[model samples]
Target: MIGRPISRIKRVVLSALSVLLLLLSYTWISHRQHQINPQDTTIPSWGQLAEGAKKFTQPDRKGHRWLIEDSIATGKRLAAGISLGIIFGFLIGMFMGCIASVEAFLQPPISLLAKVPQTAALAVYFVFFGTGMKMYVAMIAFGVIPALAVTVYLAIKDIPSEMLDKAYTLGASHFETAYEVVFKQVLPKFIDAVRLCIGPAIVFLIAAEMVVGDVGFGYRIRLQFKLTNMNVVYPYLVFLAGFGYLLDYGLRFLQSKICPWYQNDSK
Candidate 1:
């Protein structure tokens, strides 16, 4: 009983310490930026950017924000990517984990495919798909799918033979054993993989949108970037940061609810 409380305290203390250290590092880096990059011409300081954010955001006070049409486009783009990402992740992960033949046939090519940057791959996808939300979702799914599949594959691979055996002895078929034994056991890891990928997927989603999208935040940023409108860029970046944080938090909450077995894991 005493040990449990002490362990919990240690975890909290360590997390706090880690965050404090990160803040200090950021502070140190910011302080050194002026001296080390005195010759750097184009980069704006954080303080200047903060003011720009205020300026950009103030436009919303006029009552009409960007465009409702653009908002709908962005939502559709996001949903499309998420839907495909999850489906591909589940399929490939299940195959790699449960089927040795499938894993053997596809593993090397997939590994090789993963080497090319998603940005590079998106160039061709955009060309074939001819841009818009379809291309955006395709790019986001490509960027997100491989890594998430590997995460799920590894989770499935970690299942012990003894658990499978126990289920089999109880008259379960391979499919049933997998569903009942393997699937339940991997719930925590699957949730974890989703949590890990959620942030990166959002980042890549914006990047994908910026490359080929006409109306999303990414497009907005790129358009303003051409105009050297730091005011607009800063607000969008702030919006992105908040959006990503919420996506991560949502995954965490879902993880907590679905995988109660892992509620205590520090990772």
Candidate 2:
């Protein structure tokens, strides 16, 4: 218990130190920019960024707020999209993994889809779903599903044949063998795949939101960018990074709870 606590303390200290170093570096650059070119408006001071965040949280002239309203809007679309991708992708992956014929039939298309740039398909999605929340969800789902399915298929396929043979020898039916042996074995790996997909899913989410969204974190970023307010843009970008980190951490915690026996290389 003491060892674990000490390790956690060390991790916290190191993480804090890393962030401090980053801030220090930014401050140094800001100082140098002032010395060299005091007229530059692009490199915003941290204080300005904080003020921008405060302004963003408060109601704008139009009575709309980012922190309260658009943040939730983005969160909902992200949740819906990721859930749809993961649930359906897991099923598709399981089928492809368990059934050789299904794999043979689907692998080519799945591979092709995975290879295709998800951002490039934005126009196609816009045409079908139009400029609605569905378009955002559809884009993210389209981005995530194929890659996740492939990860699942490979994880299941990589399960040792001897395990399946043992299951069969023990009077387990095909479905039981597939579900009990293959599915159970692949669940942890599937979690890992989900972890991997989170970044790309956010990328697709932001891309779609920037292009077609009425309100979202991404929309706010794009809006601020258009207005050339680096103060708001910089802080929003940091917020986005923090959100992604939280997601990665949450998924890691979930993985640890569900797959206690699994050793995480990252840890």
Model 1 — TM-score against the truth?
Answer: 0.76
What is the per-residue lDDT of model 2 for residues 1-267, given as tens digits with 9 covering 90 to 100? Answer: 554545778999999999999999999887787678775547777776777888798888989887777779989999999999999899999999988899999999989998889889889998999988788888888788998899899998788889899999999999898778887788888888888888898898888888877788788889888887878888878888898889989988988887776655434
TM-score of each: 0.76, 0.91
Tens-digit lDDT track of model 1 for 1-267: 554545778989999999899767755665577578753223445665666666544446666455353456666787788779878977888888899999998788767766768766767886877776677787778777777778778887888888888888999998898788877777777767766776766777677777767677777778878877665676577676776678778888887887776786654
Name every residue pair that clashes in candidate 2.
Answer: none
Flag regions of model 2 displaced more than 4 Å.
1-10, 264-267
All models, RMSD in angstroms: 4.8, 3.4
Q: How far in Å is the alpha carbon of 154 misplaced in model 1? A: 1.3
lDDT of each: 0.73, 0.85
